[model samples]
Target chain A: MAEVKLTNVVKRYGSVEVVHGIDLEIAHNEFVVLVGPSGCGKSTTLRMIAGLEEISDGEIKIGETVVNNLPPRKRNISMVFQNYALYPHMTVSENLGFSLKIAGKSGAEISAAVANAAEILGLGDLLERTPAELSGGQRQRVAMGRAIVRHPDVFLFDEPLSNLDAKLRTQMRVEIKKLHQKIKTTIVYVTHDQVEAMTLADRIVIMKDGHIVQVGTPLDVFERPVDTFVAAFIGSPPMNLINGHIEADHVVFSDGNRLPVPPDFTGKLADGRQVVFGFRADVLMPKGHTLAESGVVTDLDLKIDFAEPLGSESILLSTLGGKEIQARMHNPRPVNEGEVLTCELHLEKCHIFDASSTKNLRE
Target chain B: MSKFSRAIRDHAVPLALIAPSILVILVVVLLPLMFSFYTSFTNYRLIRPDTLWDWIGLRNYQRLLADWDFWVAFGRTILFLTVALNLELLFGLGLALLVNKITWGQRTLRTIMMFPMMFSPILVGFQFKYVFNDTIGLVNNALQSLGLTEFAIPFLVDRWLAFFSISFAEIWMSTSIFAILILAGLFAMPKDPIEAARVDGCSNWQVFRHITLPFLMPFIFIAMTIRSLDVARAYDVVDVMTGGGPAQRTELLWTLIARTAYDDARMGRANAMAYASILLSIFFTWYFFRKLMDARKHLGAF
Candidate 1:
């Protein structure tokens, strides 16, 4: 296992720059996921690390050696593509043994390695079957088997499970995590799915338009997002961001709605300052149902447009200060549409961002 | 009408629509085929209408068994087909590979490469025949001007040179068929497996040998099948250039068959020869088709 470091990595397509100079360091054996929206350059960064895309600027180091100029094979990296990229002409046994054969290993050694990989992947019966005969999940397993057989220093995955169905994606995600745990190899995975990032990454690197926005542990980024983008991107259903301004000791919305300045940010803020109030649906629940017990419980009558009961909890769609917002309810009750329900906003669990520039005020 | 009769009438409408085509095939194809088979058993001659009633049975078949000239022509045609096909495949593959690597001007180059294939075989034959003429040919004139030779080379008169000249013209006209089909295969190939191969530590040559070549095999066999059938009717080129002349040096089956049928008026013998050559064509097509199936199975295409 080896650490991967990218110093001022930039990728340019002709005169148009796609990935700006971005620096990152992935620790050895760490599962670091580069998560972002489409065209956010996360895949480009991963490709640069894999040596599939050329590094236009700066240095990339695997362990101690600079690998900026190295070809993919010479970089000693194995990548699983989004499509699983299995060779259609070869059987499972041949696919697994390709790398070893290319490395000039003996026939016995290649067969043994292939057998071991097939065993780990539970592909004993599929050794002779070509990729076309295998199901999508089996092809994915063969792709992974091919990667692991090479024993590369770093494993790169470019949205490897995005093609699978939801259930299969989840199952494969768990298997990939388990594989990482078993092998203890440094892995850099790129995906646009935040759920996959949150569940699989040791640390999530949030990117936007070729720039790294935030790099933190899953819980850290979830509990404390760097800005409105991260706050909305991380959690399912997203965090509610209501625009407002600071006035004396209270935060005021455009529609004359008011709430006390979250006690944590009172000292650092100034009067007449514009800010956006952000909070997750789970944190702001029906009155007396909030999980945060020690926070200032600001209760308000919210008009419920509709409610979605998800068995354990219900997501109530409502509006606040002339903007649409969602509130979570734990104890399901028959609340009719257009009913004004009292909901509490946990001040301790809220995020306040500067309205003019969307940076978190609490950061 | 009853329900059964109505259903049958509906099916008849569709069948009636295609009846004209079936009639045309019977008159144009099946009738001639049956008549030719019957004529092959008789001692028929184009100039003598009375010979149509002369049923000679196995006499013409017996003569064919001892016909050394016919066998030599058959063997020579096979040799020509083999040499031309293999050379075309090699050149076509090389051209396709080189063109596939081009990024800019690719469309223009592709259009230009199809120019040779557009020319008729007769035109190609005439073009090469003049270029290889004994005294007024481009090749001999250029060679003499360059001090590479003293006397004019009788290209069409010499046995081996005539064969080479005809084969060269045929290859020039048809090699692009292989190039175009193989290029299409190259286009349809997915980029993922190639990248995966590279990531699996395969060098450029190894990736091509193990991955690209196998992927292109099915396309190659398809091209071979088509060109084999097209080349079996290699009458136009050979007839135009040498007319199977110079002591029957480059006498293909069709050339000899045409001479016997039209010039010598031996219609029965020509029909027998035509039937025999049809078997060779069928054999090559069946062989290539089998190879194509094997290649597809190897690729797991089902």
Candidate 2:
């Protein structure tokens, strides 16, 4: 295993730069996931590290050696593509042992390594079947097994679970996490799925338009997103931003309703300056005489547009003064469409962003 | 009665549209095939058309069995087919591999390679005939001028050289057919499996041997089967170059059959020989098709 580092790496295709200068450090045995939307250059970055793509500028270091000029075969890195590119003609055993055989290992050694990988992946019974006969999930396992048999210095996954069904994706996600735990190899995974990034990454690098927006642990990016994009991207049932202005030391909405600002925002804001108040749906609750009564509460009278019952909690899609907002409520409350509902926003948990820059005010 | 009439009424227009094609096939293809089969059983001659009424009762078959000239032509045809088809396949596959590597000027080179294929087989035969002439030819003159040979080489007169000369002309005229077809196969191959093999840590040669070659097998056999059928009926080049002369050293089955049917006016015996050669074509086509299906099944497309 080895730590991989990229120092101001840039990728350009004929004068148009696709991957702007990126700097990252991945320690040995760390599971770092580059997560973003499509065309975000996450895959390019992973391919550069795997030596599949050339770095147009800057240097990439694997362990202590610069690998910018090294080919993929000499990089000691194994990649599992999203399509699970198993050789269609070879049986699972041959597929697993291909790298070892190419490296000039003896037949006995190759078979021993293949057998060990098969046992770990529960692929012993499938060793004789070609990839054409295997299902998608089994093919994925064979692809992983091929990588495992090599015992390469690094494992790279480029959206490896993107092709599976949702339930299988979740199952494989857990399996991959468990496998990483067992092997503890340095892994650089790329995906557009935020949930996978949250669950699988030791540290998540959020990117947009080929630039790294933020790099932090999942919860760090979740609870303390540095900018609006990270704040909106990191969570499902995403954080809501409401347009408002500071008036009389309180945030006043466009509809002229006023709410108390958190104590930390008082000195940072100028009077009559526009701001966006950010809050996650789960942090808000129905007005009641419990914690809502004790904590600093900002009231909102919202008209319900729709409600999605998610078994454990219901997501309420409602409008406050013509602005759409989604709130998660825990109680099994019966609410009708177009009915006015009074909810409490926990002021202490609310985040404030400057209207122009969209950066978190607390940061 | 009314329902039956209505069903017939619905089918009448479509069947009417196909009537000309059916009539053409029956008049053109089926009539000739039936006439030839009938002639195979009779003692028919082109000059004496009245002899078509005679029932030969396997006289032509008996004669062919004992005829050393006919059997020699038959054996020579088989040998020519085998050698020419195999050589064409080798050269064609080499050409396809080379053309596949060329990224620039590929279209121009492809057009230039097809120039030979566009020429008539008779033209190619005449071109090579003059080039390999024993005297007053380009090859003999060049060799004499270079002082490589003191005597004019008997390219069209000697047995082995004559055979190779005819086969070479045949291969030159048809090898591009194999190359074009195999190149199409190469272009249509999926890039995913090759990339997968590379990521599996396979060297370039290993990837080609294990992945690329197996996928191209059906195409190779397809080209072989087509060229076999084509080369077995080799006549135009042989007729022009040597005229199956110089002691009939380069005579193939079709040349001998044409000589009998048209030149000697023995249509009945020629038809019998043709029916025999049809077996060779059938065997090759059937074998290649079966192998093609197996390859498709292996590729998981079946």
List, residue by residue over B1-302, the lDDT tens digit for candidate 1.
69988887879988889999999999999999999999998999999989988999978877887899899999998999899999999999988999999999999999998999898888998999899998889999999999999999989989999999999998998888889999998998989999999888988999999889989999999999998888887899899999999789889989999999999999998998888889999999999999998888857542
Chain A alone, TM-score per model: 0.98, 0.96
How many clashes (backbone atoms < 3 Å, residues ≥3 apart in a chain or on different chains) does model 1 have?
A: 0
Error of 2 at A188 (Å): 1.9
Chain B TM-score for each model?
0.95, 0.94
Candidate 1 overall Cα lDDT vs. reference?
Answer: 0.90
TM-scores of the models, in the order given:
0.96, 0.89
The prediction achieving the highest DockQ against the true structure is 1
Worst 10 residues of 1 chain B by lDDT: B293-302
Stretches of candidate 2 off by over 4 Å are A244-249, A271-275, A289-297, A320-322, B1-26, B62-67, B101-109, B134-154
Question: Per-residue alpha-carbon lDDT of model 1 for A213-276, expressed as tens digits?
Answer: 9999999999999899999999988999999888887888888888877878877778889889
